[model samples]
Target: MVAPLSAWPWENLGNFKYLLCGPLAVKVFHSWNYEGTIEDHWCLHVLLICALRGLIHQLWSSYGNMLFLTRNRRIIQQGIDFKQIDGEWNWDNFIILQALLASMACLIFPSLNSLPLWNTKGFITLLLLHVAVSEPSYYWFHRFLHESNLFNHYHSLHHSSPVPHPFTAVHATFLEHLVLCIVIGIPMAGSITMGYGSTSMIYGYFAIFDFLRCLGHSNVEVVPHELFNKLPFLRYLLYTPTYHSLHHTQMGTNFCLFMPLFDAMGGTLNSNSWQMHKKISSDSGKNGRVPDFVFLAHVVDITSAMHVPFVFRSFSSVPFSTRIFILPLWPFTFLFMLVMWAWSKAFLLTFYNLRGYLHQTWVIPRFGFQYFLPFAMEGINKRIEDAILRADRIGVKVISLAALNKNEALNGGGTLFVEKHPNLKVRVVHGNTLTAAVILNEIPKDVEEVFLTGATSKLGRAIALHLCRRRVRVLMLTLSTERFQKIQREAPMDCQNYLVQVTKYQAAQNCKTWIVGKWITPRQQNWAPSGTHFHQFVVPPILAFRRDCTYGDLAAMRLPDDVEGLGSCEYTMERGVVHACHAGGVVHQLEGWTHHEVGAIDVDRIDLVWEAAMKHGLRPVSSG
Candidate 1:
């Protein structure tokens, strides 16, 4: 299928400077019968254009992310919590898909041989027609997918990115991709049918096509509402980044592709979507800066998602018409309240900046931290994905999960999240390495033997092993001897003498100190005896956090002034109690160390103290 240089679409397509830059070697011959021109310079030309589009998209997405991470308000600009985002990417999305699909389209469709690229009215109408027809088609198609069971099977993967990115726009099912291809093909097919063929038009249409898709999925809002307000119909012409972001967050609303008209007419547009758009847009330009690292937290539900305000608890027992007024309407009222609560959460939700006592900032990537807990446990995987996605969207360089987030995410410590979202640009930290350093370093010099709880758990095992290695006596406790025996079997022989056991912590009067593990919190045991010291690895805000029976028994512990950024607050919005698991995660990410010791459960894997501090971009506490 070799064609002479004179027969090629070259001059008819007018001039594209980029295409002209490459070599014109028509000396090559083709042998594939009909699959386009295999060895032709035209194929090389098409592949180059696809490559150019990809490079542009990557740059665009990265620049937008830079604005989100460094320009916007750390907390408030980050729409959803970090865990609410689902994240995954691969080379196929970055290059292979675009190139393969574009090449296939080039061979099958009436492309470069058509007309010159610059028919202002012709190609513009083609792009608009593509959007116009694709909008309703996509809306109904997408909404139907969600309303039906097809979501979990196929559509769910695209929805997985609750915080969308340009690359994420094409990350969909094969069927969805086919539908999208047809939707895009509609205008091109129409143009050819209407007797309008231009190589420039086809290339122009696709470049615009990929650009719009990428813009819609970007983290930064490129089209502000002010533009819509000024022009009015522009809203029908353009969809901002926030517009698509809302679709991902609400999931049940904003289903249109290129514009909001379809969603508005269909009544699925979220009520608060506009307000969120305004808020995020207002934080643009000079107001859009963020830091290198910030704590992104979740709104953390201490109660049920379907629950009413706790202040209304006493109202349940009230006698207002008592049974007459409250009893009958209770079910109806409950439904109404549930609807309103969900509405408010959906529309009004905003992440806040969590400031430390030292004025350092932490980004709350989510509204509530409990998305992975209680009845919502079924969707823990999706919730975790959403959080990471949101963090990446806001340009958060590093994020640390708190409380239940850590519980569900730290299976292999931070390895689970790292493995799940390997392509995410932002760093995922457990924040445990620093916590371990603080607790271990504070092992009071006078103490000879230390009492430890939950020896079988990850944190407990690590602490016990580290203590034993340091030649400090560790009184390990467990519900049964089986786990203890396992630990004994795995321990180095010389370390056995440093490990002991006690039937009850109350009876260990000889050891006034204790190291409380996360697992121990749920055990409901009294690890805190009167006149004792506790090194708590779990956040103090946890409801299960226990206090010594003798009010003044447990001693107060503080992070050395150097790492004052870490520790719990008792009065001024208590934040930062060192959790060994979270600390270890921070260390692993900061040091760029590869420690998959989660299964092995070893504290030695944690690089704490001065070494961690040196790399943390913060000064160490005065060496005293």
Candidate 2:
């Protein structure tokens, strides 16, 4: 199985691959600072050109993956997995290598060093060379790579992504990319050698090259049908996204790089290309398919704004954490937050399929801190209500409120929406019913007594009532005796004694099991006994203060193995695991439950929801 091509030498460097061009960049800058003019500086021009290439790729990646803008027009219905994301992480590595090579070429050749800033003649020569030599050569070379051994080693890497992303255009083996450098260089080298080369022409050509490359792999149908119909020859001259996508999926056909004329000449053109293009582009209209469930979520922090699927695919695929690269993007993200606060609406984030049903995540355009602002409450509630009503209009069967979207202080856990629109079809769910079930189930069945914090909140209240029914002692911690008595009154008279109201952390020192529904600092955590295990349903999970005492994650559930296209993790949760509330919504849709689960967590439905989740293959995440 050993093949001709191998990995790039800098492949192991990860983010440090950019460092490969450091020496050359320093040389170019030093020369530019000393020299009077940069018009004849080949190295500096090469560096700037390479930087533009990377920028172009990044712009397309971000724009193409924005689900709210491009979901319906997406050529591929399938989702990208973690493996594809990892492979494409260093897609811009080739640009760095190109810069290094071009610098070396400048050093080797005296003629390439003195190119002018503009040359109409050189631009024409470059275009002719690209059309006459580069086009046909790349066509056959690309076709040759599909041959047995070459395909197995070199070409398959590029074809690995079934749903082609913008970066997928350059995600290839080192040897394959080396050949690509030659294909691109022929035009530039040829124009310069003939004394017709210019700096502007080089910039112009590479920009077009990158733009076309990104366009082909963007996975969204952007080219209109009327243009091709009005000028039919453009079909063979220019390849669309649907055209390139067929090559990745079918492999044998559409061997041309940017032009499909070679495919037509080689008798490899798929007849269905234009028809498929029309269908996909038309589908991007208002008649597109509607999802069955939508999980409405909001950004948690400034860093979290970039932890979305569209921002950076690889970063979003795993558990979200602040990274060094993301630090540089903070200012841009902060500005975006301000814009969202002023003019944003609920937008699509990501989506996946489960049991033939479409489920999507929609983002509320506000940060977590904004939800805590008293002045923003009305605006936040209006956004949530608008999203709910929109989902109802779209025929969504279930729409789940996530985190602060369902805050009791603002909208009574989605009760206000349901009450206002009593006849709405889409079931509005706060999902705390299953949130309580997940936290309660994490407790060992044999445990008799447990300390509970935020004991009067919706989830805490449900847990207290459910545990008391099982003859377990519930040490409810809250300062409001009136709220505690109100919750306790709901329990049966015989089981009311089990729900004890304790006002201090000292009351829990004797208890080995702690259910944390609110944030607890290290000082408060010290009150727990040495072996006390903390089970929390808190956001931004409390720090692990007690090394001796284990702490459980925020209640989450591992999706069923049958779940498809689940590429990104939910916040800090690991891949394939989502918060228990999101799982609750899925379970609601699967069980065909018509009732809206809002306001209070129904104590009676705790076991019923848990069993239904288990029946449908949703398993509780381990408490650690």
Each candidate: RMSD to true structure? 23.0, 2.1
Best by TM-score: 2
Cα misplacement distance, residue 600 of candidate 1 (Å): 34
TM-score for model 1? Answer: 0.43
TM-score of each: 0.43, 0.96
Worst lDDT run of 10 residues, candidate 1, spans 305-314
lDDT of 1 at 331: 64
Candidates in order have lDDT scores of 0.53, 0.89
Runs in model 2 lying further than 4 Å from the true structure = 28-41
lDDT tens string, model 2, 1-624? Answer: 445456888867877888888876777667678875554467667778987998888889888878888887888887776778877878887898788888788878877776788999998899889989999999999989999978888888888876798889999898988999999999998999899998788899999999999999999889988889899999999999999999888888988978899889899999999998887877678546789999999989899889987788778998998889899999999997788767668988889999999999999988888899999999899999999999999999999999899999999999999999999999999889999999989899999999999899889999999999999999999999999999999999999999999999999998999999999999999999999999998887899988889999899999999888788989989999999999999999999999999998888999999999999999999665
